[model samples]
Target: MTNPMRFNARIFDESFLDQCDERISAFYLMWKAKCKEGRIPARSDFDPLDMVKFLPGITLVDVERDTLELTYRLVGTNEVAVRGNDPTGKKVKDTFLANNWEDVWGNYSHVIKNKGVAFDDSDMPNSNGVMVGDETIFVPLSQDGEFVNMVMLYSIQRKAAG
Candidate 1:
């Protein structure tokens, strides 16, 4: 359950990748490698082949600066299965996932506002309707290097240890 007064997402420096799972860390590292002169990488900077391993868990969201709205541009198969529906073409504010929508939106907003990255972990609903630990990373992408127009996310789920 979420504490109404607190947000679970944490903003971290890009160097904090060491704290993440190896696969998750590699995703961030790949994005980092695509950066040019510390500028955010554009969506075109990535090649699909390089992200093959993480494709099923990836999501690309479009940011609408004028309305501060975010929409699901692409939702991976794993992500769709986990959420039990495809949210592609739907606004984030209207998407219903187990995680708090406000918190999720806030995290994405933070990434856009700062033109940086963020990391969050929380229990999420799986396809089986059971809760599982999930870790996610949100990275900003900008075509012009001055404004973030998209947020790329990758998530991995794990069962709790007994």
Candidate 2:
């Protein structure tokens, strides 16, 4: 089934850095620091210790270009807790979080296709009666410096005021 190119999330420009949450900005800054000569940073460019503060909310997704498939290589602890289950090693299209695979895939694919960052604001799933929302950023990671092989995600969960 072919899906529409536009998705629910609003893909932002670099200006998003100034308006996003400080934590998100910090994470983006860290990723930007890894870039050299305008090339997208590879996964190896990052040091785990440098990402310690954002680890709980981080996720690494592997992109299979030929098949347009996305798999969760690592799902952060905070993400797993919020979703009520770990999605690590599962294809995105098969996850319970994928109530709409097209929309979900659209967001990720946008990052890869454009080699840009995408920002998404959405209600939390499996919150078990707790009202919560998420502010997330999807960033492309290239292994060959030309093709996006993975996406690095960072999200901040906010509890809604009752």
The model with the greatest lDDT is 1
Give all candidates' CA lDDT scores: 0.80, 0.79
Which tens-of-lDDT digit does each residue in 81-111 have in candidate 2? 8777898999888883534766677779889
lDDT, candidate 1, 17-128, per-residue tens = 6566788899998998998898999999999998999999999999887887889999999899887789999998888464467677777878998877888766655767
**In lDDT terms, how accurate is model 2?**
0.79
- Structural similarity to truth (TM-score) of each candidate: 0.88, 0.87
Instruction: State the displacement of the C-alpha of residue 35, model 1, in Å, after optimal TM-score superposition.
Output: 1.0
